[model samples]
Target: MFWALFLLPAWAVAGSACLRLCLAAVRAAATAPEAAGDDRALTLYEAAFLSGGPRRVADLTLVSMARQRRLLLAHTGWATVVDPRGRDEMERSVIGAIGPGGQSRIAPVRAAAAGTEAVRGLADRLVGAGLAVQDGAGSIAAGVRRVRLAALAVCALAALALALPVPSDLPDRLVALWFALPLALTLGSLLIARMEVHPYSRWASPAGQRLLTALTRRPGAPADDPAQLTAVALLGVHAVGEPDLRAAFAHRERYLEEPAAPGH
Candidate 1:
């Protein structure tokens, strides 16, 4: 009878977590358009967003600008506006995020640039074209968080079960062994999610992922293009090949200079 007290909640928590996690996973993958839209090929920026979202787009732009000497990225992790001109909306965003002082730490600049309307605008285009994940990113994140919370809840129930009186004739290990069923469920669910849910992630839908793979494999697609689209799109800044470029991004310091004085 006492076993009923804890086992009931344990099973409930475990079942709930798995259910929520599993609910839309298949739907999420299957719902996206499987074929390309309008025969449109993914642009470098679009590829970046599809592979790694807005941040990857920002990284791609930063790397592009740095290569052109329009923006100077130092090994010490600072971004200095060199051209004060943008060739596109994304370039303008990076410049604007740096502010009029023309200098700021790379981290904040990256965050601000990534959050800019220019980036979201790109997302809008991708989603409209059926290349980006249609599922709200917040939902995906919340689902993952709920699964984690459920794991903890299951553990709590197990503890409660152990604390309560054990049914006669059943050994303590036997009770734990029985409770292991739910514990195994939570762990197995987590492992399965890590593998199955990662490929599509939050940025690219199944169709978008297919496009990314196509871009990388297309004929005459150089391994190290001027944009480094494949590397940055797939791996973000970590794939940055330039030592100083990577160092500039890795800068974790919080630094934002004041706006330039009114007069020289």
Candidate 2:
């Protein structure tokens, strides 16, 4: 009984979080509008921004620079500039982020590029064009995070309920019922969220996703071009059929394990 008393607050908090997430999911779905005709023809960078947010744009820019031979990304995660000139604002921003040395760690370059006017411009353009869901995207992401936390809280509550002693007056079944309520609520909320949010990508709304799908289906598409390569980075390797370009976009981790000595 004392354990149940201790778990009551957790149960309440989890239940509330679950309810809020469900409401948020429903509201996002209900308020989302259909895309306009012109909005369907999204540029590679624009699609990247819509599908993966500002970070995707930065990734595309880096990949584009590498493809153009203006930058080199070593497996060690260092980025070096081959050409100091930047033809466009996005390219210029990336080169500028590398600083006067013309070389820096990829992670810091990404961080700096993420704050550039070019990235901000891309986001603003997407939102203004109605291809991105503005405040709703952040809200949905937050709600999903809360739902995940609620799942953890439910597990904690269950463990607490089981570990604590029960009163003589209360049956084991009653104790189980109490714990089951919050668990069910949490699970149900997750289910609703999955169904409602599954159609939309991380940043792109349903309409943008639909357009992305159509654009990726065309045959004999060129993946070597900077624009096409940018699309490949956004849509992932599956969308790029060319082996060479696919290899170019293949992500390498920053750290690598050194080989052991021959004697060892």
Candidate 3:
């Protein structure tokens, strides 16, 4: 009982510190300009080539026309059955722009009953890219934790050694090994995690490389891009009562340029 009481405050303090660290990391990541840059690059890439800018408008018009003709049916009221022929036309256009890689070559467009997969795929790519800086920040937090854990382990071993009247050679060796091995691994992991790979980093044309990455990650419809795009669209539609695609695209660009709030 006495030992449990003595340990309670330590546990509380550690937990509090962990919470504080997590919150601080997220806040720092969210406000960072680099994180926002990822979003801008993705939006521009998609607008120029993939699903959003002109093609989506054209497709929507086609879909609307089809719906009016009753040649199409609504799956649930939220979606209408899109013509496979229209999909083929779009695929040809995409192939002309990017090349013959099927859905694998297209960065955002994915197969779905209605084009929901394609839209969602575009959104996911944007969100994932935006998260690069955040991931880096979290990695930094993790590195710090690793260091702290190593320190704590060392301290604990020392305390254990001291508490034992018969200080065996085995205990000292075990403590040394624990400190040495984990310290090396932690440093390596931290270095790799901290490597700065900007989310905004794009190709010369920007579309091809991004698409390739998307394809490599997902070989199926409903790729990450659409998911991300949907999120942004939903936010715009719900929060501001306007599906301001241009504004949504610009939001990321402006955020990226907004000088990372002094220190972070």
Candidate with best TM-score: 2
* Model 1 misplaced regions, further than 4 Å: 1-9, 30-39, 135-160, 163-170, 184-200, 222-225, 253-264
Kindly give the number of clashing pairs for every candidate.
0, 0, 18
Q: lDDT of model 2 at residue 132?
A: 62
Error of 1 at 123 (Å): 1.6
Tens-place lDDT digits, model 3, residues 99-190: 23221111122222124444344445544454322232343344356446644654454455445566344555564454444345444443
Scanning candidate 3 in windows of ten residues, the lowest lDDT window is 102-111
Model 2 TM-score relative to the real fold: 0.77
Q: Please give the lDDT score for candidate 3.
A: 0.35
Q: Which candidate is the best by lDDT?
A: 1
- What is the overall TM-score of model 3 with all chains considered together? 0.24
Q: List, residue by residue over 99-158, the lDDT tens digit for candidate 2.
A: 998877666677788789998887777666555656544556667778778778777877
Residue 93 of model 3 has an lDDT of: 36
**Candidate order (TM-score):** 2, 1, 3
Best of the two (1, 2) by lDDT: 1
- Model 2 pairs in collision: none
TM-scores across all candidates?
Answer: 0.77, 0.77, 0.24
Shift in Å, residue 190, candidate 2: 1.8
